[model samples]
Each structure stands twice: as C-alpha cells, then as structure tokens.
Target: MISTEYVVSEQPFTVRRTVKWGQCDPAGVVYTVVFAEYVISTAELFYGCLFGQGPQQAKDKYQFGTPTRGLTFDFRKSLRPDQQFDTEVRVGRIGTSTYQLLMHARDMEGDTVFTACLTPICIVRGQRESIPIPEYFKEKLKAHQTSDAP
Candidate 1:
C-alpha cells in the first residue's frame, strides 16, 4: 500500500512520488518504515530503466539475481500525506560483486528529504554464492554514474 504512482526518468534516473494517506501514521507523518519501502521501490524502477523492462522480468530473463547486501538512510525532513517529492537515483561505487545505488529525495522546494544507499550483491540464480557483476550491468550503471553526492 506504500507505493503510489511514480514517474521515472532515465536521463538522470529520477522517481517522483506523492505521499498518500495509506503511507502516513496517525500523527499525520509518514511512517518510518515507509521510507524503506520507498527506497526499494525506487530501486526496482531503476532496474526497469537499466534493463528496459520490469526488474523481476529482467532478473528472470538474465538468469541472475541481486540480493540486498546493505541498506542505509539519512532522513533530513519529514514527509506528510499529500506531499510530493523527487527521488533522484545515481549510480555509485561498483565493486567486484556489489554496487551502490544512491537515492536522494528532495522536496518540491528543492530541499533534501532523505538520502539512501542501496548495495546489492550479484549472484547466480537460485544460489547464495556471489559472482562478479556482469559487464552489461556495469556498463549501464557507469553511463549514469555521478561523483557529486553528500
């Protein structure tokens, strides 16, 4: 119920979303847990941008998988119901078996709401063992990589 309609952009890899009633708590502020959902959903859509298809579909077609290795976030502002914000996605560090997806959420006034980093480790399908990141995936991420991040 956390996900509402979101707009995705490939040029700079951004997702725009509007907070909904379902996403907020009784106190009229977004639930703390919802931030995690926002991050994961944005990452899924980012995969869609990279693969030119749905994220799960791409994973199935490629016969590979990315499992979350780590996730961290820093909240700068509170989001209330009916608020709209932009979650800009930037490709961060690329490692042998893991990569970082940096997501920065900014409010309508251009103020930062939150910043997150999602590190997903690559692995062979159906296996827990790790593998080197595929070249295709690396190249795609590099095309969108950015150096400016705080």
Candidate 2:
C-alpha cells in the first residue's frame, strides 16, 4: 500500500480587470490563457502577505522566489472584456519543496468562468535546483493555512 499526502483548503481572492483589446478572440471572449495570469497574480499576493512584502519584494530580500513548475487550467464559461472577475485561491497541496495554488475565476453572477492551478517549486537563491522550505517560511505558510481554514 502507498500512503499519500495532499491537503486542500479554499480561500477567497478577488480580481477585477477589463479584458484588454487584444485579450479577446473572434467571439469577443477572453482568451483562456488570460485566466492563468490572474491566478498567478492572486496567488502571488497571498505569498506576499505571507512574507513581509509583495512577492517581488520578498524575493529581493531572500534573493529567491517560488517559480512556476507547472500550470493547468479548465475553461468552464466565456467572459467578455467589459466584465471583471474575482478569483478564489486554494492551497491544494504542500510538498517538501513545492505547493499547488488552485484558482477559480467567477463573474459578477458567481458563475465560474475559468479554473486554474499552479505548481511552484521552492528554490535556493541563485540556484536552479529545489531546496527544502525554510523553517521560518514554512511556519509562516502553515499559519496562513490554519487561519483560512473553516
């Protein structure tokens, strides 16, 4: 038998952006890839709060930041550029040196327009390989998980 470890918890996150002129397709719907950027941006905000500053600012201090290892998205509905959407980010899993950030984008009517998740690896400064999550940062992330739990 194999044992598995994957924890999932949902948290609220909001995003408001008008579809750019070039972000829409012939159908005038937002491109699927656009949601991924929103998801990443929202997740970065959460990470920023976890650290002492924004994601880039935190990276400036530590000389490193979590880098996206993978991204997956499922498009459920269509969105127009005139519409703004809010996203919810959930921690789907936390591994020895990586975490999955799940995001769902919803319109004003609370309909899901898109869903995405990003797997980011924790790495050392100026290095390309993975590393164990720092003790201080792990504690901080755990606290964030606990506080957002229902």
TM-scores of the models, in the given order? 0.93, 0.78
lDDT (10s digit) by residue, model 1, range 1-150? 665647657778889999988989999999999999999989898898889889888888887899899999999999999899999999889899998999999999999999999999999989998999989989998898888633
Clashing pairs in 1: none
Q: What is the lDDT of residue 132 in candidate 1?
A: 92
Predictions in order: lDDT: 0.89, 0.68
Candidate 1 stretches greater than 4 Å from native:
1-3, 148-150
Q: After superposition, how far is residue 80 of candidate 2 from its true place, in Å?
A: 0.8
Best by lDDT: 1
